[model samples]
Target chain A: MNQIDLGMVDWARAQFALTAMYHWIFVPLTLGLSFLCAFYESLYVRTGKEAWKKIAKFWMTLFGINFAIGVATGIILEFEFGTNWSNYSWMVGDIFGAPLAVEGIVAFFLEATFFAVMFFGWNRVSKGFHLFSTWMVAIGSNLSALWILVANGWMQHPVGMIFNPDTARFEMQNFWEVLFSPVAIAKFTHTTSSSFIVGSLFVITVASWYLLKGRNTEMAKKSILVAAVFGLLSTAYAGLTGDESAYVNASTQPMKLAAYEGLYNGKAKADLVAIGILKGQKAPDDDTDPFLFDIKIPGLLSLLANRDAGSFVPGIKDLVYGNAQEKIVGVKAKMERGRMAVADLAAYKNARKSGDKAGSAMALQKFGVNQDYLGYGYFSQPEESIPPVKLTFYSFHLMVTLGCLFTLFFVVFLYLAYKNSLERHRGLLRLGVVSFFLGLLASQAGWVVAEAGRQPWVIQNYLPVHIGTSNIAAGNVQATFFMFLGLFTLLLLAEVKIMLKQINIGPEEV
Target chain B: MPGYSQNNIFFKWQRTVVRFYLDGFRAMTVGKALWKIILIKLFVMFAILKLFFFSDYLHTNFSTDQQRSDHVLEQITLQSKIQAVEDKK
Candidate 1:
């Protein structure tokens, strides 16, 4: 077997993160703008407004530019699974590949088919059929999000699968369980709604720019009105879904919840850290006071996590050290069990080799019993399982704060548009324009928390990232990493240039 | 789309879809020929060509699961191997 190389692991991780981050930049906009285009086209169809058609075509052009780049960024991720994390692919591909195949064969094709009609069939097809095509594009894009998120949600909380000792893999046993996972549902709704908020923010920002320049005033005003109402509705839904996400984290990944709060000590009725600054650098898994000055909301963590204000919320120390009252497994114990699980797999294989059916059965049973803690075995020390708290905490807090702030931005923008006084408040219009980055930041921060917070383990409790890297040289991976970085950066630059050029053309020309 | 095989509805739908696909190919014969090239390239690259380059090292070696896993464990826990080599030196 190939040896584990630390440098290879790091390179593979950096590659995945870089590719995924760039891909996300375009995906959210595509998702949000697809629906927005459909909505605008529907209005055009209903009211027979040439202005609405102009707006629809304008944003649709931007959407096509973004979506085209998204397709380029997207395919690499599927290939990366095999190239970088081949073991992980082989381990869970039976279950994981199903979602990817579904996304490609069904959802992607559906989106592409209707997208052609929506974009090129304006004069060729009937108005009603064109509207239907627009809506189909929206539905198809969202459906694609659903399948991808379901696959990811399985990683956060693997279910509906059983291990096969002989094949040394986890195979799908219940497709429904994988499909309708609670975490997946919550993540899908939360993520897409946040994307919608970003989309609305994008529309408002561009429209605000036009309003400021005093060109296409009617289009700008109409676009802002639609985006504000849409943004407000989706942002509200995001809050509700965000709550569900927190609930899932609190229940399944208590350690991650602790990191989110930057808490180090255990306590019932725990105070939520709304704001704080870390005092000094502390060693990993240390039980010392990690914060200097923390403004707290008493029992809010308990409330947010469990919906019961008095319920116990375990801290980093409790999770890493020990907490008898909370029954926290502590990272060390899980590591031990993880070793036993690995050992059992070895024993099962040995027994099978010797034709000892009963011994193989016993070993298989042991593996089944201990497999839940299997990933911990890959870590030499408990501290390795501890993710960077500062990053996770900051990312999560920014996502929440930005989400709340954008809700207010939408309300204020709506009010301005309604009063026909948006032109009077250039400052607010500029802020509305700035909300685009703020919205994207919030969306990306949410991703950082989700991906970075669940550190060490790529598939939550079952698999560590180090164990999944391909059997390739570190230098080779590094070379490929840089190649991808340069390529994606160039692609992103080209996309932005094309988009800016299209926007310069303005709504009337479109 | 659900297949309604109870009343041969599924067969009818399948026929319609197949006809639509054939008509599309006929309309864009050049594109259709290009698609044939694309499909052949895909088959060769993923299915036929992969077998020559992508050898399963884990399966090829370490006959038992124990041997395979131990090799991984040894790889991860490399400090002992380094220490032993240093002692021998």
Candidate 2:
């Protein structure tokens, strides 16, 4: 099978991504709302005011709904690792299994056990105990983020372990290094803060919408103010953490960074294209070739790469193939010949196997004639595969669009919050809806770019994606796919309906 | 509590069976769903079963011995040949 088939991996990745994205709609809210709930609770404790209690209770109700959705969505992700990417699981099980186990035992258990008390045992428990439970829930959520990030971080940087060829796994060599890899830290901070930003914007916008609609003024005021504070902090931190994330990416996966920036030429002073197509003659045609006309960031690439503010970063072309002067020009030609020979052999074999005598003769004739041309197909000593440049180019654009929009939306929201006009500005409230959807878009685009950019490699260089299948029959995957697809679709529809119903009803009923 | 020494074997087995069904039903029905914990327990049980029956099949199938390794390489080569023919157009 070709590397980029929209087959089992595609189906599985799409299914898993769908479920995760659906569930993600709730997770950031759970993280963001839980803190808002706690903050309201703290305010209640200090002021001994009934309004604080009302505010806390209102958001807490919303948090409970979100937390339930998050919990449901999260379960699928855990089981999916073993089911969809079984090879990846077995290969990384030695190193990866630890964090997943810890997440379950330490973070998940802590969250779940206390969440029960916080959600339902308010009357049975003391106020202090209940408050403590809420705080525990917050800690539990963040801790969950921590462990998951640690797992993902390893994928990006692949450190703190030694590859064991015997078992084909990476055995954990240093616990501390695994925990504190630069990529892991940068990713974790950036991811969690981004979630917070998403959460804050979500709450504030909804609250502002309510106020604009004349639904609940006091509720809207408190909600908007609290969410605005968190939103501002998260937005500002996202920029800072994003910078760190970029730096880590530049160091760890330079190719990914290059792809994201559309730096096909890999010039030392790589230009960041504001926009461009990655098709036809636009993309780098050969490793030694330069990209076609493109927009660029003067020296932003160098500044982002080294933080030295002046050092030039190599473009994608340069990264994939070294300087043009260093290239072996005739390599591809040789590679082409080997490929064409194989093709001719295959056609001849197919004709013979099918018992088509005339076809066999014709195929042999074609093979004899094309023998000289085979060299063109296989001249390259080591053939360099480019990403589906169009896909990468478009996915990169989608991600950048969302990023820029998010930056603008949050900046505007923050300014409005500072002006104390969040409740009054209908325009800003509308922007919230736009920003929330944009967050979803950004996350999906990010995944597409990252996964697609890694086109041939399931684990970078060592393993190919096609060879890493589960050995289960394709029928098995098909059967399971239909079953889970139905279930996930039902769950997703129900979740959205329920969430909307809760939002419309408001906390007064509870 | 049911005392072990005095009970008949049938009664003991009946109680164990009853408790098993009850625990399973509770896990399915409980509101504060401890489904994950239950799922893990179930996974371990399945793993034990696999160890007994499926482990040998797995070892034989995926083992990277020379013969299997050669077969895989041949398969990949064949597949690539087909791909090249397709790409020609």
Candidate 3:
């Protein structure tokens, strides 16, 4: 009710985004590299070859460098939830906290315990036990991802929670529903699989570097063989799960789906923008063309969204203004209903204090009817409902395009490696070395789409971000943002330096 | 007697595992660098940033859970009340 500090909210959002993006750089590598280490170790055990052991140990060392540096970055995010977004924390902490707590208490401990054994148990324990420890670390790290993604998934598509007006919180109605929500499962699979691609790329790139230098050629070849196969399979799974994500987006967050396609108007058959350049910014209701130059696959958007070429797909303008024939509720109407819900909630509280049972019941019922639109009440205009179209569109397109390229990159590398001609293709190996950075880019782009697309809402359709922010000064958040930037940059440099030094030393030294 | 023997064997195994880790860590080459990074990063994150910069607003300001909950509840409900008054005007 008091003029909300837009500056504070924006800074808080920026700070959270900065932390999350930096944290993501380390996470996917950990997720994917752990399994690759396990696979390499498994081969070592099977073959009883010192070369295989060396290769496995080499990758594991890199994984350790990454894992150690990445360890505490996530704790800052948790701190931010309580510091900058305390209101949002209180609102959904009951539901959101559950998954995060599980991740820490179960998955983190599992990973930490085995991680020591995996690193140091080579001579101390039996080969079987060491291999098992490696596999456990792999599983434990992914399980950690699973729980965090589940928490994030709940935010994008909130379900299995009942709003308790008495406590002013959303409490979990069913833990299973929260954990196994379709969005959560899709998110978990897509995220972890793509991470595997990043991990594979990292290994391939380092190995390619070795090949280029004409040093450790056998180990290089062996690393490429394992990584290329793993990368290719992961690429396929990431692609499949990515499609599933789009499908899920269409139903759960239509605005995001529309933004991904750069769709402006509703149509029975929408074309997917295969490649396009946006004509700068335009108002949601403007008559100007959205794109400058473009190529599109006919009816692909409709098919992707609704699983039918002929099925109608709504766009950004339609989402904001409403589509009559499509039976879509506009943000304006939702805002009115949301305002009514808010007022009714206040009135219900007042009535209860006055011991007016009848009045309280009436207000409570009205609130229930309009509760789904509660977040919309915070918006001052309908256009505020639309996420930043250009950012979302470009991020989505970049992720998709890079994904296609990664698939091709993997196939070619895999073929060359199998034929033992990878060494001969100098250019491809050079490209392979560069592809790791592209893989990181694609991974970041995916998060941009997921988080940026769901703008203004901390919890979809329930709480807007402005209200979610803590009543803190904008200056405080800005100062901390710079602090984090410096800290994360230092850590990133440390990680890169350590990893490079290890790579240069080669597996023979290990 | 069997359970006691099993427990003794388990303790022996645990001690060996602990010793294994201690010796391995002591003998580490690249791992020394990793441990340094971890310790420094943890100190920065927990000791400096958390201790000084970030604090749980509700917990720091409010002593009791009831007060915290009440404050949050008021924040959620108060905005609507103001909007209602504006609409009436």
Candidate 1 per-residue C-alpha lDDT over A1-510 given as tens digits, one digit per residue, 9 for 90 to 100: 344666778888988898898889988998898889988998999999988999998888788777766664565676667666766766776888888789887675788778667766777679999999999998899888888999999998899998776765678999999999888998899999999998999999899988889989999999999989999999999999999999999987877888888877867798988888876597645567788888899998899999999988887777776777778778889878988887887787778879999999999899889988877776676777778899999899899989988889999999989988899999998897788888888999999999888886788887778776666677866866776687678667767776777777787666
Compared with the true structure, what per-residue lDDT tens digits does model 1 show for residues B1-89? 46656468778878865665565455541233334444543554446433443335455545776565555434433434223323433
Candidate 1 chain A TM is 0.97
Off by over 4 Å in 3: B1-7, B80-89
Estimate, for each residue in A254-281, the C-alpha lDDT of model 2 and write its tens digit: 6667666766555444456676654465
Off by over 4 Å in 2: A1-6, A275-283, A286-295, A324-385, A388-397, A414-420, B1-89
Residue A280 error, candidate 2, Å? 5.6
Lowest lDDT 10-residue stretch of candidate 2 chain A = A374-383
Query: Which pairs clash in the backbone of model 3?
Result: none
Give the top-scoring candidate (TM-score): 3
- Residues A103-181 of candidate 3 have per-residue lDDT tens digits of 9887757888888899888887899999999999999999988988999999999999998877778999999999999
CA lDDT of A465 in candidate 3? 82
Residue A475 displacement (Å), model 2: 3.8
TM-score comparison, 1 vs 3, better candidate: 3
DockQ of 2: 0.08
List, for all models, the DockQ compared with the true complex.
Answer: 0.08, 0.08, 0.44
Q: Rank the candidates by TM-score, best first.
A: 3, 1, 2
